[model samples]
Target: MKKIYITFLFAAISLFSSCDDWLTVEPKDMVTVDKALTTPEGYTSALVGVYQILQNVYNPGGFVMGSGVDTFANIYTEPSIGFSQSLNSAYNYNFSDTSYDNSSGAAFLQMYKAITNLNVILSSIETTEVLTAEQKNFVEGEARALRGFLHFDIWRIYGTAPDDNAGTSNLILPYSLEVSNEFIPYLNYNDYFANILSDLEQAKDMLSFSDPIIYYSNELLNVEGSIEEYEDLGWYNRQNRFNYYATLGALARVQLWMGNKEQAYEYAKEVVDAQNEDGTRKFRLGTSTDMGNTDLALFVEQLFGVETLGYDDTSYSSYTAHCVNSEYVLNQVYPSSSDIRKMNLFTTLTSNALVYNAQISLKYSLMSENDASAYKNFPIIRVSEMYLILVETAPTIAEAQTYYDTFANSRFDENVTLTEGNLQENILNQYTREFWAEGQIFYTYKRLSLTSLPFSGQEMNTDKYKIAIPSGETNSDL
Candidate 1:
């Protein structure tokens, strides 16, 4: 599908300002929320606006410094030229002054803006006369799911670890329930998690009847026909939206992060089992053959992602600047030829004399040659992540091995096997390989608090793990 650009005129919604506090602008919009949702087309357009923040956050070069989750996580390699210039603070954990720069701060601000828009859509949908109840539920489900997702990410970046039972007393962020400028105080980690999960559970119920993205084909055949085409019913590709399965996947991820092993395993197992053995599943793991002949490509059967319109044309240079000549990590960790990830998803640049052979991440940057592979939607969750969750949270080592081997067998050219003894070792290895440049590796280490990383000699350090609140937000002038 051609990437659709939904114009979110922030100027129109000046009431939802991108201010330091993110809430001190006039309520000026060319179209009001009630009028905007009066038609299905307008409703979809507004829904698309809620998704715009993902593209902004995932865009490689926009606010490299403020991209705290990946930057602080140390997800990329130090460039040959700017090893000390660019990412010096993040790599060294120097986030006191420079961590919350304008770009990073803007990312944090934009998510709130998106949430504000989502809140408007959710409140208006109840009284929206033009849309069917099913249509309203679809929009409500996606809005709540996206809200939960954005808030959860905010917590990850700013708050203490969810599993920190001791840190439950400290509040970090407010769960914004309505579109208002009122300063919401931070809830403790446990309370914050409860609110986020509550939204996700509501999302799951709302999207139960909604269509899902079919795995191998990446199509949404379920929502194709019979519905009144609102500007041709643009919702067919529900993969771009947070469908039912996506919420399940998110539940699995959140549960695992919170240290709830049994619940995490159950949720992940549900997502994994959502795919059919007969190949009719809404989502499944991609094969090496599925990656096609291109060296620069992303696995397209993503459970949840945002379609990035003109991403390659606009942001490729900025993305490569941070990634191209930097020290690539897969070179050190992925030593096996049987693993197809090294061959399909990664490309080596030997011309960089400083790093010798920098293995650049082609996960989201492969849109140059093939349009088919260029769906720049940053993947929020994937099928393999469920398998990884199961591996880490299973009740027994034997059960963990069952999950591990299923993933290993599918990813490798030759059949691969793992024993109970090597379960922890291999899970970390798989995390590095599977989530290489997708901005997940650091969280894996942070959540688990591993003393050492897989390839790099970087150990668990206090500076690297914590991100400071932006000075603007810290002011008592709310």
Candidate 2:
């Protein structure tokens, strides 16, 4: 359980970048942590630094998001030649392979690095004289939420499932709370999740009163305006941040994972029913029109996500090269040809002199003529997922069917029937279609403890669901 902490200097300078005026800190301006955090601008930059880590770790090619996690789910077809060896290892569940282990290990360290930064902010934000009381609440709330968010992912990726009785009792991963290099003891599954929920609940309480998203719509807050206009408004771009709704959404997800079905249903319903002052849904489901216009990431429906740079260029190139599924697999996942996802989310690449013909996902690929900046959104949570949660956690089978019908109607112009037997199958199908390269379907299989995967009928077990902890982490004290 002994873990080393990244120094404040490295966390601040290495992760900090120019996203906005407040966050524009140059690496040349080397200053101690105390001096950097003396001003409101410095604290803001530090928080933005944590977000920057998210942008890096969850980008399309990052281990948690695109190639790594999706490959673990067996979402792609390995080409006859020139495929990435690391991804091939992931697809085969070869976590012990050196390349795959190194990739996953790097991502693990990056997440903890971000957590260290968050701990630094939380430790200093309250007593800082430069920030107002409201500013303190906002910063602390966001830090707590991000802390919970990062720990949840770590547990999902590395810890045993709560459903496993023996695994639940065994000490797993340390939930780091302080910015110290001291050894922290690992906790059982119950204690680990309790820490996650504690952070989230405290965050929810603080953000409810302090977050601007509570009173204003994301449309108005994120609306394009002059620099002076935005400066006057204080905070903008609530969609990308862990806003109030996103906290609730995260709660619902965690509750469902821990088998708190009633709580999950309630939390999800609140988010689904949330509205702006104008009565429009806070986060609406994406439609065919959105896909037709090349907004394939469905930016409108994202509850919480990061706006990434080069998502379509560098990050997506990895997908096009190694993660392309064959036409046959795509058909199996999307049985309804009329489904809008099927129609717009895929394109067949013709065989060339060097590469063979294959079907690839357009979810992350943006057209050149369109506003690429607007489409570079990488969703971590969406309203569509809230509906999915509702379907699974609904009180009765009929209630589940109603939620599914609503979600299905929004995606395409179709009337699909649902019954008790097929309801669970349909839900799984939607996960495959809705979150193809978004890195969620794999976790769904794990949470449900499915003995077989959907498309390939690959055998599954607890060992496959849990990734091996990186060797460096295992032998850290040495």
Candidate 3:
């Protein structure tokens, strides 16, 4: 049996980057609650810290899963002969390999630690007097949303699917509401979903009252009509944080996972219905022209995303290793000869001095020299996904067709028609292309329980759909 343990002190250490110098402190195993949560700014700083950790979740490569990992949605192929030790077992689906234990174990610990930090902020918001009612609500809402989001992710990777599995009584992950170091027993699948929904609903309610666009309008310089007076309030970054729509998007996703089609459609509709004062959609679909000479224009389509500060180094390496020079996988994803993405979203190097000439995806690849770091933000959700959810849960074929057409027309010159018979399958295929390296493709396969995929030599196996719990936590009080 694998020995499991949770280090409260080490987890307590903040892994936030000190680039902004907002909450910089010496490296320590523990951070006292009073020192980090006494002031309103401190709470906000902690939230930023959470975003930093999230940005690092898949660094040196944006894909959370390893390249050529059969256990995951094997969309990309690496030309390299071998993978790092942390990803070897993942590639072969060998759960018993102790060498792969650290990768999952470290992520598990970090996610829980971030949850604990969010709980601390949530706890402090009620008592902290420095913040006004609006500030308190905004802070509390973002914290709860982050907490719910993280827990939902943990449940997806570690918890067995209640929909796919016949035996739904097994306990999976430790879902906690408090910041204590005590060992919380795992909840059944039903109870786990309940806990996740509870957090998300509370977050939605809190954020409904705060209204991120208006509340943070001063900080959003990119948008029109800058409120100069409120600009000094800090927290200027928009793409990195969980705004109102992001929270709603999370709710819609959770509802879909629970098989609540009506509720999912309702929430997704709310996201799609969101419009600016001028009647434009809050999030709009991208155009072929938006692909541009560089991928920088793609940022305008993000409903929610995280700015990867290490993009130049991390995303560049990951894209080159897995996608560039791998013609088979590249052709598999963007298979259509006339696909605009194949032409606009990719570029090939041709200099004789270069080591090799290969096509790399400009979507995730960063070009810092051109000041495209703003486009380096990784998308978590988009309006395009809202359309996908709407189509997936639409009651009528006509309604689903409308939603599908709205998205397809935006991306392709030819009108892609959808019939009720092939709606689900086509939606899955669209997901394969739409998300590409966005990380939702794997979850789509798992959620729908469909067997075949775009990966080379993929077989139908339900067990491979879910990742095994890392050895470090196998015997712990989970």
Candidate 4:
């Protein structure tokens, strides 16, 4: 029996009353679990609270995406002085250090905390009388999809790479499916992955018919309509939630991670080829026009994202505080000055007496004061990633090149060719260019089992790739 330290009873109750502007709910007075679960509105608020917990896990300067995991991949420069000791520790792969607790420790706990909330929702939804059949499907599908998504992220961060055969058989983390203090057993890599796939598949089946994202255009789905216009339902901001396509996208990502290339390609192709009723692409790549308008986060391409109100004012500051190597940014990541990302996604600070010229990412920074909310989204997955998956998993070199060319052309004015020899290298380069500061390049490095990292030339091994389970968790199990 594994005794994981989780605050279910109190934390789950508190989540019901907490409301955010994006969730579009008024704060409720704290009530008992039975009272809260009695209403359909309560279920929605509970789900919204799960998302809020997720924000903490992915919070700026925290572990998962922010500066923490990115440091392990050497995305940021080691400051000359000790400005951010925690970030420095992360860059050095010192996961066991107390200084790094806020990153790895907090993320691990919060992720499970969110999972517990999802289980609480799932446990009550089936028997709840307030929801119609369609509403039940809608809510259950979202909850299950989020459960799989968060678990997969936990596996990515703490467990060994799935390709590592010896590591795959070792017991790692527990896949929490119930809201109880009873001992939950840890699962090995294979069983854990099986559970992840099961949840995602079940969610996909449910969302396929019920989610409005299947029937509406991206424009109509994300519109900021009034509560009266949307009939006071939770259907307005479809992108922020885990909709049908997002479930498919997650399936694609998971399949690729497990090395099921054919299944991965099929799942990714579905997202890339999705269409509106009139035949417009459901989700298109971000264009020069988006760059020109200072839409740095590329709102149109985001398949799934979290809405962090005041992100520009809060998380943006901590994220940009970590600087990048100017030479690496110029020569390796973005070689072409004409590339859209180079032109808009980065800004360089000129040298002064104390420091050399430093390059910083503007991907999450506020470029427009008129509508700062537009830039507040934190992308979890996007259409561009689906295209990249297609490029990697296509049946043949010719087919892969076609997907690669389309994705490359969207970011650069000049034609980017893909040959059989450069296919793998080009894919890596695209990841660095596209996902910098987005907290994905490290996973790419681990998935491919590459020993050396770009820019930093840091040699890697399984120890560096797999973060240690926090001491609190390990101790609780004993």
Candidate 5:
């Protein structure tokens, strides 16, 4: 029994990296919270296990699962939907119903699995005599917040996910995890956000302990200790776990999405104020440094993200071990003075480089063997976003100016300030440039109901903003 349970535990952790046994962990096997969290290691393992799965939720090399691991959605590059419209299958763009339908399953599967783990934590924390009350609450908060965070992701993608999981009626994911044949309840937009906000609001208060180490390296680098020293206190740092914080960010984001500007401003402010000890803000700007400094520093922006914490050392390394070289932005990089990402951060290819190289994949640079691993962890909901939310939602132009001024000047070294007539556009455009390659680009475009003027060549539809509910999800139930 011990061996079987232990195997299940290890298998869960292994799932994140496509480990031999990890990929096969079945969802049907029931492991009680009491049994899973019997020890501190068990509890930690459960939490970390879910996070590891996040690394694999999407395939990073291409679109779909890891496509937009960092904030930038890499595969979607076009005028419609702004950057991610697909011209060919190779581009792997899924801006409409099909993408959302398929993605919802994958997203829901992982989130539900994590939620189950959290449910276990929530249920057992009370019975476990060894765990402290605060510890129990912290863990529970992490789980609930994470559950809310992922659900919000689903809602964002599908637009009408419901609270009830009847499976037959609503949009849900993971054909493998479904236990019921009945229709699932699809959440309306308002309720979707309400649940998200509720979870985050509680998570904000539930999380107590704080770990100051803000950067987390890929576990693969740990072979050389590159990913090993992720924390100053080193035993898994669940205290500053991203699942909870991500929930807070989702709350602010959903609030903004719902046009509750005041609440958006409120929650976003909360996240900004919760910076790392060194004052390097979470989900803020990248490390404005030269890229070639380490040949592997190209993507160092997200090295120590909350999700990367406690994950296996080789996860990121393996993800980035093999990458095709691209030079779409060589001009951007060579000019150096244009955007700092090209100038100081990215390197110009030499005589041996390919002439048809695409843009320098501005979000991340090469790690080992020119794979995407070098790009650091990009915060999905960084502290800077909160400020932007406030500025955009400011009650008046003067208030907007005040918030926008502080946020813009502080985010980049250039110190951008908005002028009178172009207040909203200025802030929105700045968000585009500042957070390019990061995933928030589309959302920014969405909130404003603005469409790209025209890309270099591609045609974009201003009306085709919200991805329609995928046909797979539009059964008789919804």
Candidate 6:
């Protein structure tokens, strides 16, 4: 199916201001809830609207700082170019004051903005009589899950996030249920994760179908479920509703971050169990075909496919910056044939360190057919991710070896086998190839809290992983 996600005009529209700056992408105006969803169809469309924003606004993180021009690359790039920097482990960012920009923050703000859109739908759900109770429950669940997911993202990226459980933090974000101009205290981390999981659990129960719809499986929720796409005539080829499952996947990640390894394992295992054995794991690896390219690059272990919304160009995949544009993570070594990711996602940068040409991307190709050069609803989370996580987090080296081979060999050459003491190394190696340009590397390193990777024969420490909230943030009256 042709993917057509939403896109916002990133014009310089004023936020909390009426300034005429050409850079601000402000809403032309607000519409009442009554008009937005006068019917059931209207309400679901609004949900898709929120999903579109999620896909468009949040791009993945990177392995190292580089030419990507995001905070991700900024850290390594800044320090590499002689800039004094400090690390913030929370976001895995090295945010020296000088490198701050509006891009990453803008994405965070977009997340909140997406939350607001869902909030509007929710506010309407309570009052609208046109939608059924079942529909209302499902939609509300999905909306809450989206909010929790976004807040969770912000919590990870922002240093001092709010928590409903720990109400008395010195710094916290305000919780808004309606349109408001007042700044609120942030929820502490405990409350934050709690609410995020709460939403996911609820949505998982209520989520009748995914965007590419799915069904219950007796074969198990791992590598045994069928790989058929559930059709939703009402969904208009949208996957935002399918986000309920992803909510759980993301929760597993959140739990892992919070150091609840057991819970993380449970959550991840659930995803693995939710897959079909045909290698179409819950979040199966994306073949070069998945990228819609003739090149035979295969990205193994597509844990979760984040739906990609609309775009205006082929210059980049949100992850492109980390792959081809920056340090060239793929060129770090000769990737195996089983590791078809670089072959399909990037063109080798063969410039002898001079011209440095060739691009790493299979995503931007969709720009041509898209009306405004944008794609939509790329999978954000998948089952394959769970298998990989399960293997890495396995309690025993033997168990880890067993799971790693069972899950990984499907993508790598038969020569690949977990060697003694190389379990972690192999896992990280798979992690790198699996998410080469996708930005999960940043999270993996931070999650493991390890420093230094051999890139082109040089040991590099991941600068302390803290992305400084711009100093100007406090200066602004949110």
Best by TM-score: 4
Instruction: Mark the regions of model 4 whose C-alpha exceeds 4 Å error after superposition.
Output: 1-3, 7-35, 166-168, 226-230, 313-320, 351-355, 367-373, 413-416, 476-478
Kindly list the per-residue Cα lDDT of model 4 for residues 16-72, writing each as its tens digit: 554431132335423344457677767777777777777666644557876677777
What is the C-alpha local distance difference test score of each model?
0.63, 0.76, 0.65, 0.77, 0.45, 0.49
Q: Higher TM-score: candidate 1 or 2?
A: 2
Model 5, residue 170: distance off in Å is 11
Candidate 5 ranges with C-alpha deviation above 4 Å: 1-35, 62-108, 111-116, 123-130, 160-183, 208-240, 243-247, 274-287, 290-338, 345-357, 366-378, 395-420, 451-463, 468-478
Worst 10 residues of 4 by lDDT: 21-30
* Better by TM-score, candidate 5 or 3: 3
Per-model TM against the reference: 0.83, 0.89, 0.85, 0.91, 0.64, 0.70
- The lDDT ranking, best first, is 4, 2, 3, 1, 6, 5
lDDT of 3 by residue, 1-478 (tens): 1123445422223423232322322232123445566556566667777777676564425325333222356564423224444444554555666665666677777677677667766765767888878788788888888888888887777665546653366666667677555455667677777888888888788878775563443125454336564343444555557877788888889899888999999999998887766667677778776666455336666767776663554435442344443555567666576666666666664431212555555666563435645466777777788899999999998899888888877777345577868888788878877776566777787788766665645664667666776666655433
| TM-score (C-alpha, index-matched) for candidate 5 | 0.64
Clashes of 2: 0
Instruction: Please provide the root mean square deviation of candidate 4 (C-alpha atoms, Å).
Output: 3.3
Q: What lDDT score goes with residue 291 in model 6? A: 49
- Look at candidate 6 and tell me the lDDT of residue 397: 67
Clashing pairs in 1: 15-26, 66-104, 215-282, 306-377
Order of models, best TM-score first: 4, 2, 3, 1, 6, 5
Error of 3 at 142 (Å): 0.4
Show where candidate 6 strays beyond 4 Å: 1-34, 59-99, 160-178, 208-212, 216-233, 236-241, 275-313, 317-338, 349-379, 413-421, 453-463, 475-478
Deviation of model 3 at 367, angstroms: 5.2
Model 5 agreement with the true structure over 363-436: per-residue lDDT tens digits: 33333233435333433455556667777777777777776766544434344455567777667666655554
